[model samples]
Target: MIEKNHIVGKEAQKAYLIGVANRNTPYEKAKEYIEELAFLAETADIRTIRSYIQNLDRPNRATYIGSGKLIEIRTKAEEEGVSVLIFDDELSPMQLRNIEKETNLAVLDRSALILHIFDLHAQTAQARLQVELAQNQYMLPRLTRLWTHLERQRGGTGTRGGAGEKEIETDRRIIRDRIALLKKELEKITRQDEERRKNRGEFVRIALIGYTNVGKSTLMNALTKSDVLVENKLFATLDTTVRKMVIDFTPFLISDTVGFIRKLPHHLVECFKSTLAEAKESDIILHVVDVSHPQFLDQIKVVQDTLKDLKIENKREIIIFNKIDALSADERETLETAWLSKEDAPALFISALKRENIEGFRNMVVDTVRAKHAEKFPNQKLELYS
Candidate 1:
């Protein structure tokens, strides 16, 4: 099992972040990637001591970085007393083994770090089961890495296999069995959740979606007056939270699902498919953005790409540019003008934390939800704001 603290004795584990830039990814973009990776490490309670970016045509096949660069990183990490090496991209199984062997330190890729954070933040039974399923699926293919401590004996003419091989096989079997079991359990829970959704029939459903730590939970609290966990950390909300809200005599169901990030683990997405179903079934998608961030546009692209992956990109979307209080008056006005001109979707600028323009935000939601409700259930009689 992965530990949430990832601490050594009484000290928090220090990490060294590594990234590689090729033609597809230039140096500046790679720097932003490293920054995000550092944030992920911070979310996992790991301290980042240093970061290294290697400009290469392609990643090294064996170690993901050149041998000389790896050696340099190892020396600096040892000097800094770093306990872990975190990579910005998902590492192959062979690369993981070779890197660990070369560095003689604990190694983790972006996916594994996100998985650890999810493991830490999971509160409900469904979330726990989903995290466990993702962890098991991620571990199944890396069994050899997990059993590296065991010695692999030379095969004899009469022998079946070595103890390490045997142990790995056994572990793989167990994980596969566990994965099947988890799927069935999740299916059962999903059915129950489906029934609940059905029970809330005729209520307009809206899902809050955005990059991690983009104030989606804060926005949820402002819109629904329900206290969802509002945190500055990544993957803070792993379970889906639903609340009923009435605005101007119009009632609807709103949900806050787990936030998305670049390079999110496919296994995690597969495991949490049921939790994200709220968004898939929503009549309106509230795609939130942190207008204050330097890379808010890239974050929007990441969110949209994720929605495409989930096949929910066709749903009606309302881009809520949040955290406008952090921006200057001119900057906010410029951004609002540019986005509103696009007319791609209904874009609104507001600060959920400061409650700025929240009434305007509410009015927009009511209008959109009422429109969707009437489109879906034209004959239903509900006194809505004209």
Candidate 2:
């Protein structure tokens, strides 16, 4: 098996991204997805030498795309000197194996790409351990041909003859054992987290959650004046950060955690359960949306679905539509009209990047938190001068 140190050098490989869509997926939407995938590949430091799109009713069972398309991609990859192939969708293990056989290039899907980014972004020991656990769980099922080409080229005395084969088998067993041990470590951490949260008492907790690259980190910096690693890349913040903020002498806890994405892997959700508990235990959730994105509505649905999956749907929330400065006049008119027509849930518009309407956004949050606090602690009275 290739050592962990070797994975970094392999990142130098050039990549070609492929996206497939069907009748259910509109052409425009598919194009947007492909563009996003290219950006994601770039963020992972992979040079995109080429890309392909295939319109089909659905993926082929054996190879995802048709074999003919696969052959075309392989030929193009060979001509372009591409060393990696990335898909826009998660592939079944069988499909992954089939594609690897056809392409002769290292293959990865969107989930894998996201995991890789998380692996790189994880900073804290807890975050690192959580990411490693998730990666191990994901790697377990696909270990059969793990770095097969690398092994062949390395050709050490390690894998020569029956002894070599036996050694490989032993290494696989050790990986499996490590997976179990890491899982146990995560369980211990989860328990400790629960206890710590329980001991924090009755302070109102608010969580900022939204789709990746929507300026959640920027908003956090704006609110708390705390420096967090903010970037224009996906999965920039993988670990949870909690800060105490006071609004008009009212103290509340606000947390910024990993942002959600469309089709975020199920395994990741399961693995990041403790990190996400910040949202779960919150008294209010600030669902940040990039108002400037043409598909911001669709992103809202994705975040809502993810929250529902995490069983935090009934929590009180405020819709903070950010990046208002990035919208044009006509687009702003249309979005304002659309937003004004929505009912029930409270909403505010602001430009986190430009600090536009931020004071108004802060007031809205304070009002919501105060209302929730009053309800939760009936004996305490909160006064507002405005």
Candidate 3:
């Protein structure tokens, strides 16, 4: 539902963000969501003019926000000359249409915004196919919003249907067909990927899993010595990148997969499951975390929940609390002590950007990979670096 052409050129599209705070989501949390939503807009190259949050018991079914609040927003947007309204939560087709009609501006929800980001980042054929499938699925139900320009034909004198109705039906069929074709193409690519993995010859596989913008790509680059695209944006690395490395003669494959985010669309998870197969098949998962974030713990839960949903929660994980350079000495010590006391999983605190504790990080990986490599190749003798 979000168009990118306006985002191009010198003047980026200006947008106002909307969020709802309810009994479940307090004002503070809703404010955080709005901030994240603004960041999402920024990543999509949209300039966030301002943000609005309504305190409601629940979101309005028709317009998402209260009528008064929406009116206020409309007036403010007009004063600011913002042409786009981005919602923190995904809206139903009816709600989206209502809000667009009432405000007379471009409307986008969290799901549509994330999908557009994925569409922009998708590079590999498989990644493109996966993103296309998710976009089609998301667009299928929201097709009515696309046909708002066409007037509905009256069924008075033997008319089949309105142009809008007929066009919607035709578009739905085309999207459905496109979805099916994308699925088939993805399955073929999945098979090819599986074959490639099988040919890797029993190397111990380690995959990096984490929340979006948590420095997973930077860490991957640090470890593998490969120049994978690293951007300071959410969902920067959509396609999985795997490289073979030898640490003290114990060779293994390490992969960097797409990062997890809060409120990620269900259709996206389903479509990208194939892309996440590397993590599913890995022997060890390096769950990277940005310790600098205020809600770092919540981000951990989000990743854990996503892993559980993917049925890979049982994998061996090492929680790497990254970006320690952003924390003070006292803060880092406090967090490390508290987290290590939990004794849930092996945790390491380091800064991938600053090359902090890098030797320790390498030693830990070498030890883990050596153990898994021993299991795979019992007859081979590998040297460990300490």
TM-score for each of the candidates: 0.93, 0.92, 0.92
Ranking by TM-score: 1, 3, 2
lDDT of 2 by residue, 201-221 (tens): 667899999999999999999
Can you write out model 3's per-residue Cα lDDT over 8-123, one digit (the tens) per residue? 33568789999988889999999998988888889988899888888889899999999888888889889988878899998999998899789877788999889889988888
Q: What is the C-alpha lDDT of each candidate?
A: 0.86, 0.82, 0.85
10 residues in a row with least lDDT, candidate 3:
149-158
Candidate 1 vs 3: which has more TM-score: 1
Q: How well does candidate 2 score on lDDT at residue 256?
A: 94
Displacement of the residue 355 alpha carbon in candidate 2, Å: 0.5
TM-score of 2: 0.92
* Cα RMSDs, all models: 4.6, 3.0, 4.6
TM-score of candidate 1 on Cα atoms, chains taken together: 0.93
Q: Per-residue CA lDDT of candidate 1, range 90-184, in tens?
A: 88989988998888778888998899899889999999899989988888888754234211111123222334677679877988999999889
Q: Which stretch of 10 consecutive residues in model 1 shows the poorest summed lDDT? A: 149-158
